[model samples]
Target: MRRRAVVFVALALALLTAAVGIWLAVAAAARDTDAAPPVSVSPSASAAPVTADDYCYVEAMIYYRVKEQELAETLLRKQGIEAGASGFATGIAARDEDELEDLRAWYLSWADARPAEPPTDGPCGGHGSDHAQMPGMPSWSALQGFAAAEHPDAEKRFAEILHAQNAGMIALVTLILEGDPHPAVAESAEAVLQQAEADQETLQGIIDAVP
Candidate 1:
């Protein structure tokens, strides 16, 4: 009987030892799981806000071009000139339309991105008092004169206007491509500049043929 009792006690001790070992293992695993830290991200560090000055150049450009192109189209129609003239005015209407649409889209985007500040040169102040002007821009009188002149004379005026606009376009695009952070704006700027350069060459050729 004593022998049986001693054997029973030994079996109980063995079971107890195994239970302790399992408890210790489980506690270690739980500790390891709890040791992992939570992850955190900072908003300021992740996305920096773009400043108003950053996009002011584009805003000014878009505003001026929008007005100028609108004026060109209206004048063309009012003058009873051929918007689709075989040579000099070839596709001028269509090109102006496309440019106007692009300018409107870019203007809205730039305006949204820009902070509230004094209206820049290109943006029309809701009141007549404010007007947006751009580099290489011609006077209102010059635009008016060119728009009113007839056929051959208007043709010469067109060439001069084209050259001036092209010069401004090239300079403005260079600024965007070099300094602007917006990728889409930069791409659009490049596309417009290329088209302008091509248009300039064709318009200049037409002018050269005039005399």
Candidate 2:
């Protein structure tokens, strides 16, 4: 009887040891899994910057957007077309600096990315000087016409200018968004376009309410 009791105690001790070993092994495996970094199954997103073949793309892009922004600002301030339009134009005008900053960032990145190559592609069409001035700038006479008018006349003139300017902006925006082809430029262009869309609605409201 004594031997049997001792045998039972020994078996219990062995079983306890075995159970503890299994638990420890499971705990270690759990800790290792918890510490492991999660693996991404898909590739990370990539940002695509523009690769300019020439400087004309650069010159044309800057001039085009600047003019559009300037036009909106001037019309809003000088003509006093509508209060709501002023807000919209204000939003549009603010983008000029933002776009400029984007261009600077793009150029710096371009240079950094191609330290040895030195951007041998040169200006668009083989020369930067070949780029022409941005088209559709209102003449001095037209400027005077809008500024000189009062009330109904000024509003009418502003509406004409607003539509015309927006038409011109489309192509210029397309150029920077795709013409120069920089990620920064494209993003800025998209933002500008979004604001322009909102401005269009505002302009319509202004026309409806004031006229």
Candidate 3:
């Protein structure tokens, strides 16, 4: 009877030890599982605004061209010429110094007829004038003469060409600076900018030549 009691006590001790070992293993595993993965935070995304240089360049070019067009349109209007017909006439008209001089005279006359109104708005707003009458703008007739003599297609064709070229150049530059990955695209864009720069000089020369 003593041997049997000793054996029963030994067996109970062994079972308790095994159960404790299993519980310890599970606890260790639970701790390791919880610790394995690290918590992570994602970065916030945002876009940069366009720079002042970009805005200024685009705005100045557009303003300059549109002002020229307005001058041309106004000149045509003053001559009792229908807008569409005058546009067509300018496009097809031969370049003649005498004709251009006559047109300039007409433009100056129209300008002289209007008494200068006091500026209600700032200089940038053309002083609240209907025609944005400011100093150094070629008279409407002079603009018309310029269109007729220098660039018969100045209003439509020349403007369209310049606008398209500039727009493409701007887009290309923007894409490259924005980190476009395609090598071919980046190279093509660079080439376009170079070409457009060259073309810009020619256009400026034409603008300067307008009498």
Candidate 4:
């Protein structure tokens, strides 16, 4: 009888020990699971905020060229502009129209879609009035004044405005070149910068000759 009682107590202690071991293992696993870090998720490109870069240079250039082209065509339509000024306006109109078409195509290729015509009202808006804050962009009143001027005044006004706008575009193109622009955008910007520089030289001569 004594031997049997000792055997039974030993069996109970072994079972208790086994249960404790299993409980400890389960508790440790739970702690490890609780301590693990959360899985991270990346933000989507489409979720990019409006304040982000969004290739402002490309769109801004398009806007600038559109306005420049319009002004050039306006000058061409006006009477009494000197032969030199008329020729300059004609070149500007033609060059900008071609560039505008190229830019539209480039934008479509880059974005996989076309940007809105006339753009929306912000930096991303290709032709937004907000971009008027850029240096050398003529104000509404200045555009009106240019439209109304005649003869020598018209020539002088066109030279002054176009010169300023050209300088602004050159600066913008230079900035894009300095930064990490897309290959297509960089190529277009380089062409624009070169043309704008040459145009500026011509415009300077025109301004100097203005009587």
Candidate 5:
């Protein structure tokens, strides 16, 4: 009877040890899993890749047009602009409005919404800043200066700003054309480039005529 009791006690001890070892192993495994980093899986590409530069160009051009329209409208409001410059401002206002519509249409076709801010560095990721500064566009101070000036100064400033804006537009269009732009975008850019070139000549003439 004593031997049987000893044997039973030994069997119970062995079972308890086995259970504790298993529990410890399981706890260690759980800790390891908790410490492990999650594996990341990349999605397969299903469509043609679009570059940030291309996207920036489209949105930036739209911004350019809107600014141009504003400047033209301001020119019209001035009291002393020459007849020719005033006529040109009117044409610019009309043309930019039409182009704005076209760009908005193209933008809406793919983009869910327009960019809240204009890109300055030819990329889309740095849109966190609220200031819409871009090359070829007049600074706020310059615009203000133009507004305050009289006659020849205002006209000269207007001509210079517009010329710079046109140059910026042409550069962006040319950049887009050199890449794989959408057919509609390509067509519009070519038209814009031709128009900008013509406007450059006209602006140069205006600048020269300013006294």
Candidate 6:
């Protein structure tokens, strides 16, 4: 009887040791998993700066104020006449007199917004001239007359104006947002000149079509 009791005690001790060893192994694996570093992902890259085309449009509109207003008036008239003619040509074309009237009003608004020519004393502390003579400068009267003509078929002309306007607006917004600190601002200003050149070409096309 004493031998049997000792044998039973020895078996129980061995089982306990085995169970403890298994539990310890599982705990060590759990600890290692918890210590492992988490996976990381990088952020997306920033967008490129606005294009030269965009800058030119804004500069022409904003800096060459008088010329731009003249251009706007001419373009608006051409668009209006074309829109009216389209309504007459296609029975489906609804004459939104109100919309046309609103556009006319906006055209006038564009004209009104222009800054008068700076005196020789200069506006904005003579900073105007430094930017004024920059490349792609348009003659004020020439662009004005170009803007004034009627276009019975002004779809192409209108498209050109719209493109120029959008580019200019984008450049203006960029300048305002980024705050032109470097010489890049001047380069951006030259973009306005480029837009004026484009506008001139479009205007000439319209002039050629005029009766």
Residue-pair clashes per candidate: 3, 8, 0, 0, 0, 7
Best by lDDT: 5
RMSD of each: 32.9, 28.9, 38.0, 32.9, 29.3, 33.8
Instruction: Give all candidates' CA lDDT scores.
Output: 0.51, 0.48, 0.37, 0.61, 0.63, 0.37
lDDT of 4 by residue, 1-211 (tens): 9965654564454335433533332243345544322212234422333222235664566667766766666677677778998998888777775555544443433443334344453334444433555657876556656666677887787788889988878876776677655555566778888888888888888888876
Q: Which candidate, 1 or 5, has the higher lDDT?
A: 5
lDDT of 2: 0.48
Tens-place lDDT digits, model 3, residues 59-90: 22233334433333433433344344355335
Write the residue-wise lDDT of candidate 6 on 124-194 in tens digits. 22325324443234433333333333455344443344345445445443543355322433453455445
In model 5, the runs with Cα more than 4 Å from the true position are: 1-54, 112-131
Poorest 10 consecutive residues of model 3 by lDDT?
38-47
Report lDDT (Cα) of residue 25, candidate 4. 28
Q: State the lDDT at 30 in candidate 1.
A: 40
- TM-score per candidate, chains pooled: 0.57, 0.49, 0.26, 0.64, 0.67, 0.27
TM-score top scorer:
5
Tens-digit lDDT string for candidate 5 (60-178): 66667766766666677778789888889899877876565544443433453344455544433443342154558676567656656567776788889899988877877887788
Instruction: Write one digit per residue (lDDT tens) for candidate 1, span 1-211.
Output: 9965654564454335433533332243345533322212245422444434335544444444544444344335444454332334545545654544444443443445655655433322221222234555656556556545666566666667667766776776676667644554555667877877887787677567665
Tens-place lDDT digits, model 2, residues 173-206: 6555555544444555676667656656665665
User: Which segments of model 4 are wrong by more than 4 Å?
Assistant: 1-54, 112-130
Off by over 4 Å in 3: 1-168
Tell me the spans in candidate 2 whose CA falls farther than 4 Å from its real position: 1-50, 53-61, 68-81, 104-136, 175-180, 208-210
